[model samples]
Target: LVVLLVRLHLTGFFWGDCSLSNTLFRRSAGEFAAYLVDAETGELHGVLSYGQRAYDLDLLSTNVFGELLDLQAGELLDADVDPATLVARIGERYDDLWRALTDVEEFSVDEMWRIEQRIERLNRLGFDVDELDIVTDWDGATVRIQPKVVEAEHHARRLQGLTGLDVEESQARRLLNDLDAFAAAHGLQAEDPMIIAHRWVTDVYEPLRAMIPDPLRGIVEPAEMYHDILVHRWFLSERAGDEVDFFDAARSYVESILPARAATVSAAETSGPDELSAVSPSDDDPSFD
Candidate 1:
């Protein structure tokens, strides 16, 4: 919590409300990351005062307590757990998060590669630092820097750039990694990542998608389907002691795995796609019986 608060402060924003429930977790390059979601009440400030920061922490504790109580009521929390202690622990976690996001490093001017290193650090934390606010003093001897316009969900944009597919942040990160691996394994190199992503989709993703029978098509989203297919391929390769052909793995996935999942319902509570047509009047039928 402290870490996020520090980063937000460094970036010139005040999170008026901060709590566990207001954040979502995603895995970035094998590390867990927290993203702020309830920013509707947050304030953008040039700097946060000590009192303001404390108030945010207080709100966070209160919110955590309430969430724990609610979960207990719902029978989701362990009976032995103490909410007060848990709330305190949450603060520690936030502090660590804040440090990771805003900690600075000193590098000699000769080590210009540190700038790229910093960007890579932020990307692994699931952020894109759109602007780096760097200042060179009058002496032109010292450099001070902070990231401005830092935005969350970095992988989502990268996935869109590559595949024109927008997925949950974590899923996009996973898919992007797989795409890179696919490119390397095929000895393909091009500046356009999207071209490679397109080839993978058309050659690999779409064929697997088409294998789904119409009756079971709505069980999962296309991106999720593709993710599962990749997992299946890995397992198949491991079992056979050789790389499984993509098409063969896809066929096995569609036949064996996808059928057992529950059918995905439409947003309006309709039975299925055919449900609409079944209820509609036929063109030749008279309105009056």
Candidate 2:
């Protein structure tokens, strides 16, 4: 909800009565994605003033607070959830997010590093700046810069460029992190990313999936399985007080964990790339099993 509101505000959208009750959520990759249900009261502007965003955030906070109260009354709220403190941070965090996305940043001519820093932060938040505008005063002592055209899929596109993996944005980010670790561990940092990516997919990812027993093949998406293995590796490493390699973690996860997990793919699925084809007996044998 916070991210949706923040992005909307960044694009000069004033969602006039946003609320928890107005959201529809779906399990996206590994996170819940929310959609705005009621847009009849919304307004779009070329640009929203500070007071406008602040007013919208205030309304959002109130709606969230009211919803939390209802949830608490019905015993649907978590024990650790505090409605008051959570609502209080809404405005402050939105302001910070708004600034990070659309705010114009100025730096002295010598401090060119700030430009890359700003871009890195935006990329980390899953934004791609298609156009950047830089202006310098007559004195030429400093530069004023702003991201003009921003879009999502910053990490997804990069991963696609290297590995041709079309995955959800969060999944791409997780996979890229693992790919970097794999490259560094294998002393392939100096090699081309495409070359290293091919090796990583063939040597690391495919092999991991191949290790899954036929019964558990439909438990989860292959990329999601690899993502969990990376997470599981971290947990196993922490408990053992040493870094656990992928092989050790994957072996333990398959034997001790994967079989116990409920399959995400429905049993109704009839055909998939991994399913075996029916074998027909040759003319030499009339019987076919």
Q: Which stretches of candidate 2 lie over 4 Å from their true place?
A: 12-14, 24-52, 210-219, 259-289
- Report clashes for each candidate as comma-separated counts: 6, 0
In model 2, the worst 10-residue window by lDDT is 280-289
Model 1 Cα displacement at 212 (Å)?
Answer: 3.8
Error of 1 at 272 (Å): 22
Question: Model 1, 135-186: lDDT tens per residue?
Answer: 6667766666666567767898988877787676767888888788878887
Structure candidate 1, residue pairs in collision: 1-94, 1-95, 2-94, 2-95, 3-98, 4-98
lDDT of 2 by residue, 58-171 (tens): 899999999999989987687899999999888788777767888899989999889889899999988888888999878999999999877776888998998888776778
